[model samples]
Every structure is written in C-alpha cells, then in structure tokens.
Target: MPTKTDEERVPNFGYAGFRLDAPDASVAWNLQRGRSGQNATGDALPHNPTAQTPRRGAPPPPLRVSNPKVLNYLDDRCRVHKETINLCKSVLQRKSIDWISVQRNDMSNPIHDVDLVISVGGDGTLLRASHFLNSSIPVLGVNSDPTCPDEVDELTDEFDARRSTGHLCAATAANFEQILDATLDGSRQPSELSRISVKLNGLQLPTYALNDILVSHPCPASVSRFSFRKRSNTGESSHLINCRSSGLRVATPAGSTAAMLSAGGFVMPISSHELQYMIREPISPRDADKPLLHGLVKQGQHILVVWYNEEGAVYFDGSHVMHSIQHGDTLEISSDAPILKVILPENLLKQGS
Candidate 1:
C-alpha cells in the first residue's frame, strides 16, 4: 500500500517495489462452469508460454528430471489394467520411462513436451490429454471403469449407454469426486487455470486445458452459425452470436465448476478469479433444449473471427486433430497459464482421511 498515484512497473531482470491496482471484482463465469473445470478438480490450462526461445545468453541448469509415460487414450475406447499396465510399466521401466501408444489409429507424432501423461480413459480420455498437451503436460486419469464415469469408478461389469453416474467428475464432472480423492491423495489442490491460446486461423494456438473449449455444428439438429467474444478490464468486446442452437462454449476454472455446471453455466470456485471462456450460444434442439442441442454459437465480439463453417467439428480433446473450420477462420480465446505441475497420490491432499 504505497502511493504517488501508487506507482507501477513490471519490468524484469531484477526487482523493485512493483505495484498495480484498479480491479475490484467481476470474474465469475459459468457457461456450464466452463466445461467442468477438468475433473477431480483442475482443468483448463495454457497461458504459461514465455520460455519458448529465450536465452541467447545464459541460464540453464534445472531441466532434467523427466520420466512419465503410460498414456492410453482409450485404447480402442476402453479396457486397461493388466495389473495397471504392469504396475505403470514398472514405474516406467525403473524410472527410465518413455511412453506413447494409445492409438485411435496412431497418426502419432505431435508432442511438444511431457513429464507426466498417464491417462487411461474416461473423462473423454482426460479431454484428449488436455487437447493434445497444450500447457506442455500434466495428466493422470486411470479409470478403466470400475464405476469410473467419475473418480476411478470401479463398478464396471458391463453395459453402457454412458452409465456410471456415481461420479467424482470425469466427463461431466457430475460432482467433483471429493476433489478426485483430494487429487489422488495429495489432498485437494487443483487451482491452476490461466494458460490458454486458441486463436484459430491466424494461428496462436499454444493450447492447454482443464475442461472447456468447444465449437460444434455438425448439425444433427441444425441452427449452427457462430461468433461471440470478450476481453476485459474494461476494453475489448465483439459480437455476431447465433449458433443455430445447442453447441458453443468456452470454459475454465477447471471448467466453470464442471461443464459450466451441466450446461446451465456458472460455478467458479478455486479462487484468484478472472475467467474467460464464455462466448456462448446454444439454441437449436429445435430451440429450447438448445444449449445441449449441443451448445452452438454466434452473438458477436471480434478483433478477428471470419468463421463460416459448412458443418460442426472443432474438438481439441475429443482427441486432438484440428483442421476443419472454414468461411474465413479466426477462433482466438484467452486466459493464459500460470502454473500447474501435479503428480498426486500421497493422500490426495487430505481432509477426510
């Protein structure tokens, strides 16, 4: 609390009484709690990309402790547990791990970084591994179904339409599974949302997720047209909203409290807030169930977005493979990564232990 008008600066190389103030509060978004905030608690990531190519001079020491791989992105949709894949591959072959082979058909060859990604399946295979490892990487789902529609569910014996609603939240985050068993027993700790970069078309997609970022319209119901954007402290906003009905969302805060709280949208909790991922519009389940008519869009807000699509498909986590958005393309979304490096399973944090 210092002042001369309070002084302001953030330039680095050293440090100095840095300062900033002028924001009181306006960050409560829920487009369905923005895609369920990435189940077991903590999803929606991607704003921490500043270490890309810096260091023409010096600075290099702490970067060699890597070894994590047992990713099984649904291996033909589901069925993993040969003793948990040989005890997580014997701890990555005695800690010399290097995995990759959970193919839908293996086009495989698109990884930027990885230190931990052992998703087995369910919760849409961990949002297709946070839509293809955007904030570099950090994942561990392992719920080959034992009731795992939520929280490593273990009731599976067979029969599905999408059963296993005894959730702790995986796909829909149905409930947050006691914070995913306190984040695998480290005791509740998923609050790392702030890294996001999906400005499709002019290409700024340095992706990262926790659960929420979709733009569908492969119409089985129709009403698909799109647009809606906002950037603030109190400055940029755009619009053209239409989304022919039931398909359009952008969520984070571990997904606005889970699929934005089941598509009614709004459930932000896990603090420090300033959410983005609310360019919503979902109207064509003929018109009223519209938002789940699969969540469509088009309301307006743009510095760029010339979209025109002939029909839906902008997935990112249904299993990363984006390359089908037309009419002039531009789908930029922003919130940016801060920090998230989790490896839970010590006690999943602990509060009911």
Candidate 2:
C-alpha cells in the first residue's frame, strides 16, 4: 500500500532552463561583456579546504553576501555558470534524461510542453523564467554560487554594486543533481508556493507575481493615496480604508522574506496559503488615522485597492514590466490562483522546521 504522501507525489522526468547563472554583477557583465571581450570562468579557482560545505556532512556557515557584492563578481559567476552547466550535463548523462536549455533573454513561450522547469540563476532569473509559465508545472531553483567566499577590500566608483544573490533559492549547484534525481524518482516532495493574482480595473493582468506586488506613486518621494476594502468569507466588507503612504505592498508567503521583511512585516511560512499587505510609511499622525497598516487576506477573500492619485503605478515582482494606474482605477488582488509547486530540498524543510 502506498502512503498518503507517496500518492501525492507526481514525477516529471523532463526539465527546462536548468542552468541560468547570475551574480551581483551579472547584469553589468551581460551588457558589456560582448563589447569588452570579458568572459566569466570558474576554472583554475582554488577550493576553500577550510570552509565547511553542504551535503558532504558538513554544516554550512552563515551564507551572507554582506557587501552585496561577492569577490571577482563577474568572473566568479562565470565560473559558477561553467560548473553549473557541467554538473547539469553530468546528471542528465548519468540518468539518461534529456533536457532543454534556454538563455536568460528568451521571452517566448517555449516550455508549455515540458513538465519540469528549472532556473539556474539567482532569484532574479527564477522570477524572469516564471513569467512564461502559468500552468501547474513545478519549478526548481539552483543557486549558482553555493560555497563562494571572496572578499573585496576596496570599493570602486566605476564598478556596479548591485548583487543578484539568490536568497530564495533552495538548491545549490553542488547538490542540485542529487535533488533533481530525487524529484525525478518521486522521492522528494514538492511544496505549494501560492501566487498573487492582480486585476486592473476589472481586467485580468497577464502575469501573476510569485513574489510581492508593489503599488506606488509614479514620481519618487510622493504621497500615494488609495482606498482599499476586503470581501469577507460571507461576501461582506467592512468600511473602506483610506490610506496615505509612500506605497503599498501585497505579498505572498513566498515573498514575505524579501521586501516585506525589510519593511518590518511578518515573515510568513513559504507554504502558507494567505496573502499579506503592508502599507509602507503610513502617513498619519492623528489618532483617528488608525488604518489597517498590515493584515492577511484569506485564500478566498479578495482585496481591492482604488487609486486616488493621478500618477500611480503597479509593478509585479519588482520587474520593469508594469501597468499604469490612473485616478479612480481599481486593482483587485487575490490568492485564488493555482499554487506554484516548487521543488525544495529535504534540508530546506528541516531548516524551516
């Protein structure tokens, strides 16, 4: 007899885009590498014999990109790409599994027929790839730099400091092969990461955000006014909350650890089905201004926000892809979409516990 968990496991042998590598400086390198003949390579790099590694029975230290930029950012990331590709090839060759790979810039709908989707880069790459997927296909994220330890002593003005560290990534290049094998063989379980669906004035938006959705004033440092109301389980709604703040963020559980956390919101469990909204810098000093600063929306409940400002914008998952909101425009956000099945390692589950 099969166990209850075993009955729920669905194995998808085919995979797509399993090796997109990115670092804090990948964006800069991608733009200028072709012009400068700069190449990122991981070969000839020395191993950190002293630093304890993961899955080899050694506990990993606090993995922090303190400076936001890692050592030899571009070259190291290139090395990560090289190692990741090699590892991916080796795993597929060993298991006789065929896989398809795509570049980070490809925007076409190419993975509709594929069952499994893999993102090889950091969190940005994962978000970019998810835009093309809307079905129930499971996604696995592989962190390119797992045990990378490089220190840059001096900061330069010309070098870009923005880092693309994969804080939400579950597997590293060193252990992705093993994780992939378990997922293929129906040994590893998948977790449902719910996504937030957005609507623009009664019209459905094309893409949903796996992370948080940001609504803000078009001009920076301007006040954003909006009125929001939530429909209850019985289809009843309380009085509308007139909000004055810098912006608003409606985030899913998977996005709790990102901008929501930095803004002092609660860190929700990745598997939670509820959605949370935080009013950023709520602007009111009066006692009567006791608005609902932050709260959670149940799975079936829907929250509608109406823009009161003439210049307002909506960004999905912090991407440049956006839709403008004008005065009296309504945006409805809900957690009614199908869950995103993300392949997580056993160790991640243990840590969460």
Candidate 3:
C-alpha cells in the first residue's frame, strides 16, 4: 500500500545508479512492500522511507552467511578478485548455497539476514554496503588497497595482510554497537555517535550519524545563507553563518576523518574526541558583486537551508539520498545514528585483506 501521490509511485525502482535485477520480481515486490511507508507530505507513498528511526531497539537478527565474495564493479567489468569470488563460491557451495555477486542496487535482495558481509575495497565501499544492508545488518570490512600507510591500514584489517597485500581478514560491526551501548549507558563521556542537524523548510532535525551526513548545494562552489543555533547559547538562537562554500557537513566520529577532513574539517577520533561542524570554502559578501551566498533565510529559530538549483541531492552516510531539497525549504540536519560497526583486522597487516 503506497501513499497517494499526484502520479503513481511504484515501490523504489532504480532512480539513478541502482535497481533490482535479482533472479525474479518477487524480491522487488517484497522490497516495495517492506518500504511502502509514508512520504514527507503525510501522503503514504509506498517505498518511501523516512529518516533513520532513532528509538533504541533490541539487536537485529544475526546474519546467516557464508564466506564473502569481493566485487569492484567499478574497476573492470568487476573489481573483485577472481580468487575471492571462487573462495566465496567454494564456501557457499559447501552449504548448498550459491553466492550471487552484489550489484549496486542489491538492497532489494529481500533477504532478512546475512551471516556476513565482507567488503574487499576501501571505506567508500563499506559505506555504500552499510546503506544497502540498512542499519540492521553488520558488515566485515576488508581493505584491499596496499599503498596505504601502516597506521591507517591497521584500523580496517583483521588478518596479517601485506601492504597492497592479497590477504583475507575481518573487522566486525561491533564498533557501532559499542557506540550505541555507550550512548545508552550514559557514557556520553567518550561518545562515538555524531550529532546531525538538518533544517528542511521549517523542519530542524535532531539526528545522529554512524557515517557522514552532508548537504549538497544546488549550485556548485556557491556560498549559501545557512543558519544554526550555536551550542553555546541554547535559548538565544539568533546565530547564522553565511558560509561561502557549497554546503555544510556533520560527520560521526567514524566519518569525521573522511569528507570532513578532505574539506579542511578537523578529524575527531573514531570513538571519542569532539569535532563540531566543519564549514568549508565559504563566500564573503565584502565582494557583494559576486554575491557569494545565493540567498539567506532569517526565519524564527527554525534553521532553513535552501538549495536553488534545478536538481540538488543530499547523501546520507554514503548510501541514502533525498533529491528534492529546494528553495523555500529549510534543512536542519545533524548525525542521528551511532557509528556502524565494521570488522577490523586482528593483525592490521597482510593477513587481513
């Protein structure tokens, strides 16, 4: 049952770079059925998903899986090593199961639980996998890159993998659970969850992030009129920063070192450390002729972030997307979820690939 809309919406079919090409249509139908929830307009648009559900719940069912297969559809026809695929096939075959290579839009697999999800790429691949698996399933991250420095590689590997080494290792989704446990245990002392604040129209969000949450401006490299309430004066909420760059970003302890760092934002430790908002390449009005900020929003306490472009999109974590952010709309966003646990290698070297 989908929400009523001007035009009929058929579950979540492929919009941009994803779609279900499973063995049959049942997977698509079930996925549509599962996601057939309400949309932003209160109108029930089946297949439309709301932001992250934040009330603490019980642990998700354990994933039933066989050895993992690695694929890099981006590299050659596939980037996954032929050997890894064979390994997964061998293990799955032993269990009378056939391993299907994961596609970009395999999110509609309809399988409730997977025993394990092993990534053979970098952090980016893990991020995308997290989205496809939803927050319920855990993943084992395997770094296949060899050129990375020792210190950086240690966090993602589990086996004794060599640099650019062809080693197989593991890291669990335990980190996310630890962060959640700490949050519930009243140990915000060294919290890893990131606070996400998104203001859409008049909707200011109090969200959390397990990965990175970013705002993509409609215009490229253009300054925009964004407003926010600094943590200092809680009651007095009249502080706005006409940032000169494209957009603002709020990263979790896990993602703080990612895009946030690339944009010159500080990198907070993955589990502790407080790294607030990282503002990037902002425009200065002193040169009004250039009008760094396309426009500004000075409404009530409600922070309004506007994107005035033909097509603007926002990337949550590295997986989800909301493509309709526009003018007259306020986006108040911050991290809303805890860090997603990704298995780390025990040896932090060539053993874990």
| Model 1 ranges off by over 4 Å | 1-118, 121-125, 128-130, 133-145, 148-197, 208-211, 214-248, 251-261, 265-353
Instruction: Locate the minimum summed-lDDT window of 10 residues in model 2.
Output: 23-32
C-alpha RMSD by candidate, in order: 21.2, 13.6, 15.8
Between candidates 1 and 2, name the one with more favorable lDDT: 2
Report lDDT per candidate: 0.39, 0.65, 0.39
Candidate 1: minimum summed lDDT over ten consecutive residues — where?
A: 25-34
The order by descending lDDT is 2, 3, 1
Decoy 2 TM-score against native: 0.74
Best prediction by lDDT: 2
Residue 202's lDDT in candidate 1? 58
Candidate 3 regions exceeding 4 Å error are: 1-80, 91-102, 108-111, 148-199, 202-210, 221-223, 231-238, 273-275, 285-311, 317-322, 345-353
- Local error of candidate 3 at residue 280 (angstroms): 1.7
lDDT of 2: 0.65
In Å, residue 270's CA in model 3 sits off its true spot by 1.0
Ranking by TM-score: 2, 3, 1
Candidate 3, residue 342: the lDDT equals 45
The local lDDT score (0 to 100) that residue 308 gets in candidate 3 is 47
Kindly list the per-residue Cα lDDT of model 2 for residues 264-329, writing each as its tens digit: 888887778899998888877345445566889887788889999988999888854688899999
